[model samples]
Target: MRHLIRAEWTKMRTVPGWPIALLLAVLATIGLGVFTAAGNHSSCGGATTVCPPPTTGPDGAAVDDHFYFVHRSLDGDGSITVRLTSMSGQRRLPDAVPGVRRVDTGLVPWAKAGVMIKDGTRPGASYAAVMATGTHGVRLQYDFTHDVAGSASRIGPGSPRWLRLVRTGRRITGYESPDGHRWISVGSTSLHGLPARVQIGLFAASPGALHVARADLGGSIETIRYSSTTARFDHVALEGAAAGGWRRTDVGATIDPDGSVHHPGAARASAGRYTVTGVGDIAPRVDGMAVEKTLSGLLVALLIMIVVAAGFVAAEYRTGLIRTTLATDPRPGRVLAAKAVVIAGATFAAGLAATAATLPIGTHVLRDNGNTVLPVSLLTDLRVVVGTGMLLALIAVLVLALAALLRRSSGAIAAGVALVLVPRILATTSVFPDDVARWLLRLTPAAGFAIQQSIPTYPQVTAHLVPQSGYYPLSPWAGLAVTAGWAVLALVLAVVALRRRDA
Candidate 1:
């Protein structure tokens, strides 16, 4: 096995064009990524002002993080209960057309304020809470992106609402009550690995913009700037050995002045009662416009790799080198495997270096251009880098297998490139609708591109999540598996073709 790999490596290096092709793959991937990144300017007016705030979805990509919080650490099992006296907000109405009824102001449905238990003060942490919303009534929200509605009772100046969050071990239960004493369970969730110490607090946040369709005109949704929510909390009480004196810290947007509409007032305590007000989100923003948007270059890189991999094996057959090489080693399968190992190894190395370089350079360019770059965990970034390399390597191997079966560079390269690129093009372009595009991606090797998707489609967020909108229908790993299955199947057929037929 070792000798076979060494021989194949020697042959690969001796070929002048193969090495140049690998180098081109690296340059094209990085160059295209940088160009795409540099071209993306921030939509927010300027860098000095926080135009697009940070908020995130379930996948932890930053979305909109404008919110206010007043909290304290709870080191053990505990519960926090508070009476929501009133919740109010103003929402912008769509532009009025002549002769049509002009709607001016209304409450944004998801504007929220509630009692929460969070892993920490950081955005996108694992946590759960029960809250009263502006127009959506009551909800049980967990893990920054998941929302479940509770009682249908309306929240207003005349109607008072009570929210309670109880922590028992790793499980957290949320309850709502018209009066503080009697509780109705809203929802329950387990925050796995929640530490003994966590931030349990009061929070308020409203989406910066809401999209509302004009009543008179269907299929036209207008984006409206949402007004902030002011929630008055009284009779705030905590029960647990670890819950005592509380602390308050602002997360993303700063606390506003006392008289301001967006003021996130400091919590005041007197006579076993606490009052706190906040205006922004405690969740991270989704910045889908960054790394995920710059993937056009990856397709170019994949094309380069397909040509190189197909030619690698087809050249041996073209020059009648396979017979002489196999004459020395009677086992044909070993030779095929050795060739695959060499191609996969070199492609993985080049892809990894190129992808790693592209991400940081692209990110710097985006920030310099005044674009908001959403933050992801180090783990997510590492997965993207490694996943890209694996994707390229798998595509190369798939091309090599096709070349083995066809024994013609042109035929194999064309088929291989079409298999991967054509489906993706059709899915992304308007030629196919979203559902058809999604099905093509699911059934074809192009689904591998899902590995590059960073931003998740959140149920709470109203944005285009189609392929053209920079979102993939499949999860990252699942998409990779689809492509891997194709590669494995091709390799098996190639091995069978080699064993049965003359090389």
Candidate 2:
């Protein structure tokens, strides 16, 4: 096995064009990535003062983190209960143009004000809350993105609702009540590693944009401005050892008499009652969209890889080198396996270098161009970089298998590129309907592109989650697996051909 692999490696390196192709792969990947990132600029001018600084979600996507919070740090297990007397907000509707249709004016359904327990005040920190929403009634939400609806109940001056959040160690339970006495459990979640000292608070927030579908236009549209929500809390009570000596601090936006964008109204407390008004989202915005844009160069890199890999094996058959090589090895399958290993290794090395170089340089370009880049954990970034390399290596192997079966560089390269790249191009363009594009990506080898997807489609967020919009129908790893399956099937057929037919 070792000798076979060494012989294959020697053959690959001796071909000068093979090395040049790998180098081109590296350059193409990094060059395209940097260009894309540099060209894309943030709408906010890269200033937190003008717009909320870009924040990350638990899943590592970038988001807008602007809201109003009144909180106190607690030292241990505790509970906070408050009665929400009213929830109301002014809805800003877009003006009607002479030709353009007028958008409706109404509160976003998820706009909320509630009692919350947080790991800390940082934008992406884990936390949970029980809130009264603008139109969705009550909800128990946790992390920076998960939400669960509770019983529907109207909240106003006459119809008051009670919310209680109990923290016992790492577990937090939410309960709702029509009157202050009879409690019904909304939901329970564990905030892993919730510190002894955590923030317990009252908060209010709404998204910067509301996604609405326009049937006449045949797609979705976003609201031009945000709507603010206000809620009055009374009978505020705390329990357990850490609940005493409370203090208040605003979490995201501040109160300004001048009525600036950064001002989310104010929180006022008097005689055990509190009134808080705020705008902006408490949840993280999906960062995967940015990642897709930054890494758009991967398509070009993969095309270069496909051509190089197909030519590598087809050249052997073209020059009748395969017969001589197999004459020495006799076992044809071993020769094919050795060729796969050699191509996969070279592809992986080149891809890893390209991706590693692309991310930081590309991210820097994005920031310099006034775009916000979402931050992910070091582990997640590592996975993305390494995963990209693995994806390229597998693609090379898949192409090699196709070449082995077809024995013609043109035939194999044409088929492989069509199978992988064509669908992606069509899906991203307006040439096809969004549904057809999504299905092509989902069912074809192009699904492998999901491996690069970093943003998630949140149920709570309103956006088109199709391939054209940078959202993959499949999860990252699942999409890779589908490509792998195709590669394995092709390799099996290639091995059978090698064993039964004359090389």
Candidate 3:
């Protein structure tokens, strides 16, 4: 086996075009990635203030941490209770006349209001809350990503809801009640290191309203309109070491040039009743430019890899070198295996170098250009870089297998490229319906591209999660498995054919 692999490696290096093709693949990957990242730029805040990076939650994930908070300091073990009497929201609509914006009473489904216990006033602080949502009824959420359903009934003036949060050391428990008398446990979780002093508050928040429409040309157009939510809370009580009076803060509120809050949330207090209005969400960030957008040239790199791999095997057959190879090994299966290993190894190495360089360089360029790249975990980034290398390697192996079966370069290369690229193009270009597009991504080799997805589709957040938007139908590893399956099947067929047919 070692001798066979060494012989195959010698053949690859001696062929000048093969080596050049692989080099070109690497260059294409880096060149296109850097070019795309540099080309895309944004004028964030008109150069006065560059866009801030997304708020990172306690778990190190990017999160939306904006809301209206009316909090007071609490030391030691404590609990806060509030009765949400009403929930209302408004959405900005298209102007009826020039310079005249119109607004309508409405609510995005995820609008929230109730009691909260947070580590501090800072955005992305560790916290927990029990809230009444616009349409999801009552919910208990903590650390931005975790959510638990409390009730399915809606909140209104006629149907007020009572929410409570109790803190004991690092542990926090949430409960909901219909009449503030009978309570049901909603959920409980422990903050890894809860501080002795924390902020207990009543809060309100709403995410942007989204409208998606089918375009005449193709695909879908999504518009996110400004929206805000307001909630009235009364019968507020805090059971613990209560400090001074309540303090109001619009966490993550935008500031205008005059140093005034833009689209600011408000907290009003009167006779122990509070009305809080807030804009923005408190959840995992599901919208933004993903880090993988830099790797836009991967398709071009894959094409080069496929061509090189197919030609490597087909050239041997064309020049009648296969007979000598098999004559030395006397085992056709081993010879084919050697060729597959050589091509897979070469492509994987080149791809790894290209992607490893592209990700960081492209990310830096994007950040420099005032674009906010969504933050991902170090593990996820490593997976993307390594997964891309494996993806390219498997594709090269699949192409080599096809070349072995067909004994021709052009046919095999064409089949391999079409099998991978066509499905992706069709799915992303909206030539087919979204359902059909999802199926294409699910079953085709193009599914391997899911390995590049740095942002995941979150069920708690709403957005346009389609192929065109870079969201795949399958998980990253699962999609790679689909590609691997195809490669294994092709390799098996190629080995059988090589063993049975005359070389």
Candidate 4:
């Protein structure tokens, strides 16, 4: 077994074309990634100043953390309760009425207004709250990504919703009530390292309304319109360790050149009643330049990989080298396994080297060009880099296995390309409708590309979660498993055919 593997490795290295093809694959991946990064520039008023980087949460994942707050510091264990009497919002219209910018009274489905206990007024700090949403009813949300549904009822002047948050050390619990009297626990979460002194407040936040516009060509484009939410809170009560009077802060607001907040949210108080209006969200960021976008050249590298893998096995058959090689080994399955190991290892190493270099360099170029790349956790970043390498190796193995079965390089290469590349192109290019595109990615070997997705879709945030937008229907490992399943099946069939055929 050892000698057979050694002989296979020798043959692969001695072939100048194979070694050259692998090198070209690596160069293509890195070159294309860096080029894509260089091409992308900030469109935020031609300056990077207005295009601030996405806020990162406590977990270091990109998050949206903008809202209006009327808060007082709590030095110890405490609770805050408020009755939300009314919630209203307005959305900007795409077309303006003559000389006037038209606006409509409406709220995006996730607009929230409620009571919150937060570590600080700073964006991305750990926090928890019970809120009344536009259409999602009452919800308990915390730590930027966690959300638990409560009541399915809406709030209005006649029918108000009561929200409460209690903080005891690091644990925070939320409760909702139809009336201020009877309360029901919504949910609870630990802020782990919460500070002894924290901000307890009433907040209002609204995410942008998403509208999908059909393009004249064929595909659809998603556009987010500006929207704001206002909530009237009365019967506000606080318990335990209050430090001072209420403070107003437009948390996460953008500062203008004169140091004033631009498009700032507002909070007003009168007779112990508070009206808060906010213009952003508190959820994971789903829209931006994903870090993996720099690896746009990966598809081109896949082509090179398929060519090399096909020739690895098909060349042996073409030159009648397999007869001499197999006669020495005798057992065909062992020979096939040795070839698979050699090809997969070589491709994996080359891919790892290319992707590891490409990701960081491309990310730097994107930031240098004033583009805001969405921040991902270190684990997620490592997964993308390592997963891309694994994807390449799996595809190479699949192609090599097919080449063994077909004994013709062109046939195997064509089949491999159709299975892997074509599906991805159709899915991402919007050549097919969204449903068909998603299915193409799910059922085909192209599913492996999901491993490159850096942005995770959040149900709490409304955005375009589609293939064209770089969000895959399947999770990373699951997608890779689909591709692996195909590769393993092909390898098994090839081994069986070799045993029965004349070879």
lDDT of 2 by residue, 1-503 (tens): 89999998998899898898889889988889988787777676555534445666556556555667888778788899999998777655665665554444445777888899987777777788999887788999887678888988868768999999999989999999999999999999988778899888788886644544443333333344557777899998878666445555456565466866464457788888888888777766654336546676777888888988998889989999888888989988888899999999999899899888888889877766666666666766777788888888888899999999999999989988888889888776656666777788778887887877655567666455667667777888888888888888989999999898864
Writing each residue's lDDT as its tens digit, candidate 3 over 418-441 gives 889889888887577777889999
Q: Alpha carbon lDDT of residue 293, candidate 2? A: 62
Instruction: Put down candidate 4 lDDT per residue, 1-503, tens digits, no spaces.
Output: 88988988998999998999899999999999999888888766255356667789888888889999999999889899889999999987776566677689987899999999998899999999999999999999999889999989798759998888998888899999988889999999998889999999899998888888765545568888889999999999999999999999899887899999877898888998999999899998876788888888888888999999999999989999999989998888999989988899889988898899999999998887878888888899899988988999999989999999999999999999999999999888757777788999899999999999988767888897888889899999999999999999999999999999945
lDDT of 1 at 144: 68
TM-scores, in order shown? Answer: 0.73, 0.82, 0.93, 0.94
lDDT of model 1, residue 374: 70
Compared with the true structure, all predictions reach lDDT values of: 0.77, 0.79, 0.89, 0.89
| Ranking according to lDDT, highest score first | 4, 3, 2, 1
Candidate number achieving the greatest TM-score relative to the actual structure: 4
At residue 452, give the lDDT of candidate 4: 92
Model 1 / residue 271 / CA error / Å: 17
The TM-score of candidate 1 is 0.73
lDDT for position 498 in model 3: 88
Is candidate 3 or 4 superior in TM-score? 4
